[model samples]
Target: MPKSRSRHGAKPEVSPGRATLAAACASLVGIGLARFAYAPLLPAIIGAHWFAPSAAAYLGAANLVGYLAGALLTRPMASRLPAPALLRGFMLLASIAFFACSVPVSLVWFFVWRLLSGIAGGGLMVLAAPTVLPWIPQSRRGVASGVIFAGIGIGIAASGTIVPLLLQQNLALAWDGLGLLALVLTAVAWRGWPARSAPAPTLAARAKIPAHSPLPTTRLRALYVQYALNAAGLVPHMLFLVDYVARGLGQGLDSGAQYWVLFGLGAIIGPVLTGHLADRTGFGPALRLAFFIQAGAVILPALGTGTAGLILSSLVMGAFTPGIVPLVLGRVHELLAHHPSAQKQAWSTATTAFALLQAGGAYGLTYLLTATGGDYRLLFVIGACAFALGLGIDLVVGVSLSRRRFA
Candidate 1:
């Protein structure tokens, strides 16, 4: 591990735990509330006639597009903005975006706000690492990062549980309630995110690539494809799992919502469990495990959304949804470590590549789902195929990539 020291002379007042907590809250807003909240809101969003059912996917796509843009700009933005300022600013923007959804805005306006909210979510994901990582002691970084990232699951659990209940009262109130909740959380963490005076960390800058570093282009590209496949595979479940339970299984919407809640509960502990599994079995084995489990989870619902099958599927799928990324990134680091230089660039490149895949996949699948007259079952099947291919890639290319050396 690199020597732990504060950059740009950060103050001692803010404990590392506080900073990690702030990152967790930011993750809640940036991703949990801003992005994933939409899934629960989907049926209501369509029911209220905010947009046509056919256009629901496009609204979701807009957020992913903005997320890609924000990720691309993350490195540059971190350098320019203080970690706290950026965190607060983007968080406030995200909160406003949530509030804006409650109003009867035109479809175009809703799309615009969704895009803005996506940007906030992306910024939070990119910034949270640099903001929290450097502040913590070396020995605790792993655990702290896990806690911070768990904010996504926390937010998901909150949304799945709360949003359904809120929808019973009024859909607009649900949006308003979420926005208010974000504001309250932001206020609590406001002091902890590092200020302008503190050291503002940069992801690409921290690892510092050597000029003569060899490009492990093949391994890197393979990693990218694998990451993309993993993401593309999960979209159907992430976006429409609740609806699937209700419509596909002939269960009611409330039953579908309950499954979403179960998924969120699984998500909350997934990162910790995933990290432990990777430690014992290795990231490769872990990736393979996650892929297979996720595949089965997606496919089970399709084969038969029986009560037991749905519950089991929900647990496994939810656990691995947020759980897979850390393992993938860990694999990326292991591959780049041997190179000695360009590791940081490789990290940035690999994540950027994955983000693009997510964005592109969102757009493509939205179009596909709409074109097929909202054939969600077909989408899940396609997702399962994607997961199957990812498993194959890991068994073949992933194993080889781990063994090969770059000169």
Candidate 2:
């Protein structure tokens, strides 16, 4: 939905630092803990023989399905409740979902909770950028978005370290422990959120995209497709790198975990660097550079050997994976600035398209991997190709957009 720019209370008083921190906490609880927690834990769950490989794959995917579905609910929810309330509610649900996963019920129950957690993660992601970005100064938006998004890195790093330690006690402890961590993060973020923020406007509540618009319908359609491809491209590394390192490369679990740490470190640095670059150079150019960089990163591991190659590859993939989010969001705002009425429509439409396709890959790739008998090479190859395709489309569309601006 259109990112909320309006304040609910007279002052909408929350310190920028607090707003950013709340946004980061949302990132932490949402995708960070909700999603990445699964990656590190996946091997452990497997080592313990809790479920068959195929079943585990399905469980991993169930969250993505729920995430896509939950994302669809955000704009609708926004029109009904204030931003802060919606965010708060989603955060609570996220924590509850995490807590539920700790319960060691049947596989069915675990999948259900994973799905619910994914849904919460998706909803929070949809709203967080909208909720926080508008409050910061324009010049600082990229950096602030980076800082906010850095929570993902922190979450990944935390999982890489904490999950392994927790698993030593028991799988139940690991899941339960993460749930508690989510609660702690939520509580820390609770007081920082404003009483209210701009509500998402329903389609009926806002001006419709004009029949004859400044941005062509055809161009927008291409952008949507490109976004979907981009979404699909990221799944391989984020979900499978550790598995690939330990299982595929025969590097062992500790080696895989260490590389995962490298990824987390890269992720922590990626957004701020890319955001600052986007600030100085412009989102489109920075995006192009990132896509190309990510293309190389995704392919590097497939080509290289030993710890050095894996670490370098993970570092690159980690940095570019989540880094792409804030950059694209900034580009969306920049592209639609002249068409004020279309801002919400453009952002919502574009992001939803991305979410659905990514969800498709998340759900589908495991089957592909499982069919290939857990050969992750095929998965990364597919991911790299997808990113390459996305980069080509972006380059073409970028040119088309520049032409239109002058035309």
Candidate 3:
């Protein structure tokens, strides 16, 4: 989706701050509340006997499947429709999905609602940042982007605190509370969407080969695989963290929720801290180091689920969950330096790849969980190995580049 502009190609008069706020709210509702909130609630749904554990895990995967579909479809649909309108519709759709999920008439019914929420989330993810970033001054875009994505953290933190409290009463009430929160966020963002401006570039136009650009095809291929592996590596934590805490380690729901809260706290600062690190160390170094650190963090739980270990694991992994985004984007910018068009195109492809692998990984892990009878440790070990593999790719690519430069 293209940035929202006005007639005559003038920048939209919307306040950059307010527009940023709106986009943030969209992300919070679309991704934060709609997607991540389900993680904390998953154990509750299973505990309440609403669904078998394996069945509920599959339901969680359904949202990811829908997210992949939505990501693939959003740009094409945007071609025929106003992006702002579509964003608003998606926000509303997500809120409605929350309410629909509260009913839980059957497994299929709950799956469809979760899928709809995921679709809404994917639309918001694709459309929200692009729609508002143009309004931000170039010098301040970094801070603005961080603020917008922080909505995901805020939502995560909010769910950690709020869902547990709501679940105290009943599962239905918990879903209703989330729906109400989403509606409030939607209403706050209702007016800040930029009006449609210039027509979006055609797919073919965006995809046209840059005949003589300084593109690093070999390194880019490595980056794409690394990104996919990173997505897969995160599946265990995203879907099972709370459940592992509450059920796997035999901690109660309240204790598990506390760990999630720590995760949220880490998420809230992850982007800002990681972005600052990237600025200081350069994207390549920072990204490669991140892979190594994340591998260790992901594997911590499998090694020992003690209080200290879980805390460290939750905080570090939480930080990297959303934190990896800026690092990847910065790397893309570095690779495609002075090529704005290619940067955008490459980033779009990267996002699609991440979504595709994220969905696939979710289902893969879900099946593994069923096969192992929900062996949380095995999942964490597998996730850590993925990060290790990504790190290995980066190292190999770096060595190749060094050899070619000396030759």
Candidate 4:
């Protein structure tokens, strides 16, 4: 970390915990509220006659498209503007988007706002942790990151628990309530961003840094594919799990939201648990295990939507949803442990791949749902198959690498 000082040339004290909390708030708005909230809200939108079921589903996909655009553009945008300013701006944008959604103006209007929120979320997701982690000590960074990322799960849990109560009044009130919650979070995080500029490095200090090594291109490419596949596998649950439970099972909105609540709870603990497992077993084994477990969870709904089955599926899938992020990143760092630059580049590539497939899968599944008259089971089955393929890639890579090591 670079030395930071005030304008008077005196060292400024920085609190890593406060900074991490601020970043977590940003993520809560970006992904937790912006993206995950839409799933539970989907059924309600359809029920209120705001849009046809198909249009509402497409609206959900619009956020994914914007996320891709935002993620791709954030690095370049940061080069021109300060990260703190950008983070603040994105949070504000997301809050505004939520307020704008309160009125169902038209499909195009709703889509544009949803897309903007997605952009805000994507930018925040990319920038938040990177901004805060540099200030944290190496030993505490893992726990700090888990707390920051847990904001997503927190948001999910909040929406599930809060949206229903808000909807008791009207759909507009529900939207307004969400916007107010986001605005409050944005206010809390307003001053949390650390100072951007660090003191310049001396020439001698710069010379001590080693050159980046060549990347493990083959393994990286495989990782990217598996990461992309994982996104495809997650789309069904992320977009339709609430709807599947509420309408598909004829259980009503309240019951479906209950399941989402469970998913959120799983998400809350997933990162901490998965990170611990990786520490003991290594990132490779942890990731392989994640794929296998997520595959079973995704496929469970297809085999049977019994109450116990749905409950188990929801918890497991929810846990793995955000839980898989750390595992993939740990794998990336492990693969490029010697090359910090390459690690950043590879992680960016993996994120892009995930976003691309996420958007594509959302649209494809929406179409499939329409064609099959809303066959929720088929979507779950397809999602499971995607995870299965990702598992296969990992197995193949593991075997091939083992052979190379032995040879």
Candidate 5:
């Protein structure tokens, strides 16, 4: 029997399976290798006199700014170029730019390279849903997005394990090696990715949504606010968690590193599990659960005085926080349907907002920490409040959406 028609009276068709999976995996590789590898390696790089403390922070901020620009540009670029070609180009640029970190250049040059890498990484993220979403059955989008995001966990784990060991022997060599690895992975991805036609119907159909569709506009705005707030809450932990463990809790470098590794481990598992749960329960409830878990996790350290408390807090926060990105994006996919143009707009807008929010979070933490005399406890308090606020907002949005459906 023929498949039932969609709301628009078009026969539903399943997208090709292998090709879609390959593309999604490639996107994961690109994001994992490019965006995440830096954090794991930053300590070693800073210790080696490669970047002064202020310079390193500036470079990180620059990367965030570049990401915002890239997210804003992704849709316009996709409109003109083939998605595959654009993906290949962005991957290559990011790979090369990251490898440039090994050259021991001036700090100015380092910031430039990092900024370019950030831009490329942003493009890859914004492009991922549009490039891969069409190939996924609507019913399976949550799982597919989870699977794709799981690559981030793998990438984080790989960097944590490999970079530290390499930097132990030689920092420059490790940076160079990481770059080479990214290049090879990009090549592998390019080879495996399927060819796509220009001006595809999926793309065109997505672009046709009326400007007044409450679904896309409201959902996109909600996601942006949620993500931004979440990112703000997370930045303190991402940047200062190690310092808190090492200085605040009196842990050694190795112990701090292990803590990060545990965090990465949780990150690896968080998305897949959250995605599965979202599929069964709905994104709204899943996100609320995640935020509450994160809120509790961040506050644990503040409540405790010993190593056990800190370690437990680290693991819990790590597990819940990073996974939120995929969950939020997956929800966008669910709300917008599988249309290409709408996907592009939704992703681009959300990502851009996310990037800006990340930047704001970083800067906000910086100022707050400096004002508080480098006291992270106060930051944790702020983060906990922010997470609770985000959870409340998400619940409200979910309830509002449900009421609209019945009305």
Candidate 6:
């Protein structure tokens, strides 16, 4: 193990536990406050202006495209900056850009700001786990990761509830208010943030391997496939779940919103429970279970329509969807224990691939729905099959990796 030291040659007085939690919260507020918040408020924002709904959707896509770019940028930057500083800077930019969206502006301006927000959002997401994971003890890593990811659920719920309520009073005011709140949280985080000591040179040397290197080639390939498949399955839900309910199930907007509330609530519960389970069993088995549960959840909506079915599917899908990322990251962390450089490289590569897959899937599904004249059932079928395929691949790869470990 590498020796830990303070950056100033003296023991820096700071609480690792508190700092980790704060960082996680700041990251949650940073990345998600803008991205997730926008979806719920898009109708109001567009309604106040003359821009076409399609243009509004394009702006949403722009945000995702920027996220893809940010993921690419994080690869080179993560090693250069202190993780805490990187996170704070990104959060600041994102909050400001989100606030900028309050003004009724040209569609082009909205697109630009959304794209910038996406970049910052993506950077925060990629950096969040890697930054905090090092601070947590090994025994607590699973739980810690779960706690951090729960921030996403919290942020989504906050956005969903807060934005709509604020919009009821005033749309522009709502945007500015949320943005200001995020900014305040960011500043508090900056003040309390602990300084990160430099990691040992040996650890950096170990982590420097390229993605094509033989050591991580197999694991990296498997992870890419897993992420891409999962992303394909999830894109529909993230982008169109509300639309699906409203259009196919004949539910009103408020009813659709309630389904999202259930979804976010499930996300909050899912990670904590699954992380504990993973620690007890193993990541492979836990992941296999999550995949199966998620697959079932995806197909449930297609089966029937009622408040009961909608809520059931929402909870199941929500619980499993966000659970997969952290578990895979845990596996990567395990694999790269001996080689920190290799681990980081592998993570970045996989994350970038995941982002691209998510973008492609979102656009692809949107196009398909449009072409089919709002036939979401076809999309759901595709999503379910994709998830099932992911589950099968996970089982195969997981078994092979397990045997290799024992050997």
RMSD vs true structure, all candidates: 4.3, 4.5, 4.3, 3.4, 4.5, 4.3
- How high is the lDDT of residue 8 in model 6? 23
- Which sequence of candidate numbers ranks them by lDDT, best first? 4, 3, 2, 1, 6, 5
Q: Write the per-residue lDDT of candidate 5 for residues 215-284, one digit (tens) a residue.
A: 5566567777888788777776666676566555667456666777776677777777887888899886
lDDT of 4 by residue, 1-407 (tens): 84543322434245667788898899889998999999889999999999999999999999999988888888889889998999999999999999999999999999999999999988897788777765665445455667787888889889999999999899998888999999999999988888664333345545654565566788889999999999999998899999998999899999999999999998888876786677677788989999999999998888985999999998898888878877887788778766645655677678888888999999999999999998999999999899999999989987898899899
The C-alpha TM-scores of every prediction are 0.87, 0.90, 0.91, 0.92, 0.85, 0.88
Candidate 3 backbone collisions, by pair: none
Residue-level error in angstroms, candidate 1, position 222: 2.0
What lDDT score goes with residue 135 in model 5? 51
Poorest 10 consecutive residues by lDDT, candidate 2: 1-10
Off by over 4 Å in 5: 1-30, 197-216, 247-250, 338-341, 398-407
Model 3, position 270, has a per-residue lDDT of 79
Q: Is candidate 5 or candidate 6 better by TM-score?
A: 6
Q: Give the whole-model CA lDDT for all candidates, comma-separated.
A: 0.75, 0.79, 0.84, 0.86, 0.70, 0.71
User: Which 10 residues in a row give candidate 4 its minimum summed lDDT?
Assistant: 4-13
Report residue 399 deviation for candidate 5 (angstroms): 5.2
Model 1 lDDT tens row, 159-265 = 99889889999989999999999998889789986553334445565557455666667766777777778878877877878766676566766787888888888
Which is superior by lDDT, 2 or 6?
Answer: 2
- Predicted structure with the largest lDDT when compared to the true one: 4
- Which model scores highest in TM-score? 4
Model 3 poorest 10 in a row by lDDT: 1-10
Clashing pairs in model 4? none
What value does the lDDT take at residue 243 in candidate 2?
83
Residue 379 shift from truth in candidate 5, angstroms = 2.8
C-alpha RMSD in Å of predicted model 3 compared with the true structure: 4.3
Which tens-of-lDDT digit does each residue in 137-248 have in candidate 2? Answer: 6788899989888888888888888888898898879988998999999898888777655344345534564545567566567667767787887888888888888787
Error of 2 at 98 (Å): 1.9
Off by over 4 Å in 3: 1-10, 196-211
